[model samples]
Target: MTLLALELLIMAAPDCKGNSVRGACGYGEFGRDINDGEVSGVSSRLWKNGAGCGACYQVRCKIPPHCNEEGVYVVATDYGEGDGTDFIFSPKAYGRMARPGPEFQLYSFGVVDVEYQRVPCRYGGYNLVYKIHEKSYNPHYLAVLILYVGGVNDILAVEFWQEDCKGVETHEKSVWSGS
Candidate 1:
C-alpha cells in the first residue's frame, strides 16, 4: 500500500504472450495472461527471491500529456534489472500507460519516472488456484504454483501436511518434526 516513486522501462518480453513459460519466477502459463497480459518484470529490490511473483501494482507515468492518470495495473511475473529502473513493463502494459494517442512519443522515452504502489489483484470470478508444476513427482518432489492470489501479503512459504508425519501441538499450533 505504500506508494513509491520509481523509474520504469519498456521491454518486449514473452511474459505478455499467452503461452510463454520463460520467466525467472517460473509462473508457467499463469504468467502468460495474468492481469490480461499486463505483466511486468521487477527489479531485484522487489523480486524478493521469487516472492514478488503474482504481486500486483498500479503504475502511472509522470508525463502529464502523454500518460494517463490511471496508468496501468500489472502483475509481477518475472525478474528484470536495469540501470535505474525498478520495473520493466511488457509492451502491452507500457502502451496502456499512454493517454489516447502519443504512444510512440511515450515509447521514445524508453524509461520514464512513475509512481507505483502495491495493489490487490482482483480476478473476477476466479478463485485461488494451485497448479502443480510439470516437474513435480508424487510423494517425492512437489512444486506448486499458486495463482489468483489477491491480497497485499507476499507469499513467504508453503507447508504440506501429511497424516503420517508426527507433529507437536504447541499453543494450538502444529509444528512438524522436521520442518
Candidate 2:
C-alpha cells in the first residue's frame, strides 16, 4: 500500500540521529543546525532513488493550527526508515506541523497526515562552495573544503588559478574534500 499523506510519526531535527546528514545518498555532514525547510526519507526504495541526494519536495500540513498555510519547501537532506511511514523534520518544522502547544506535548498526536508533492526546486549557485579558512595563508600552497551546497556528490576536483600576480598569472592545484 502506498501512503498519500505521511503515515508515521515524525521527530524534531535536534532529537533525530545525527540530524540525518549522511542522508539517503550518504554524503556530507548535514548537521541539525539546518533551516526549518528540510525533509527526510521514506521507504528504502524511495531513498535510493527519487529522494536521494538533491531531490526537492513540498510538504504541507494542516494538522497543527499553527502550521503554515503555504507549504514548506524541503530538500532531501537525510534518510528515515525504509519500511515505515517516515518524514523526520527539524524541531522548528515539526512544531509548525503540529498543534500550537509545548514541545513535550506535540508528540501526543503520534502520527500525522498531510498533503505533499514533489515540486521543481532550484538552488541556483555552485553546489560546492570553497571556504578559504582564516589560517590558510601560505605562499607555497593553498587549502579549502569543497562544501556540497547542492547537486550530486560526484565532485572529482577543484581547480584554481590566479589571474595576475606582479604581471604574472599563476594556477595552483585543486583541493579534494574526500578524506
After superposition, which runs of candidate 1 have C-alpha atoms over 4 Å from their true positions? 14-19, 125-127, 164-179
Global lDDT for candidate 2?
Answer: 0.48
Winning candidate number (TM-score): 1
Off by over 4 Å in 2: 1-3, 12-22, 31-37, 49-51, 64-66, 98-106, 122-179
How do the predictions measure up, each by TM-score?
0.83, 0.52
Error of 2 at 21 (Å): 5.2
Q: What lDDT tens digits, residue by residue, belong to model 1 across residues 1-179?
A: 45799899888665434225676667666677777888888998998877777788999999999999898999888888986999998888998999988988998999999999988788775646666656555665555666666667676655666656433221101111122
The residue-level lDDT of candidate 1 at 72 comes to 94
- Worst lDDT 10-window in candidate 2: 170-179
TM-score of 1: 0.83
Please, what are the lDDT tens digits per residue for candidate 2 over residues 69-116?
Answer: 555655555556622565665545555554345544555665656667
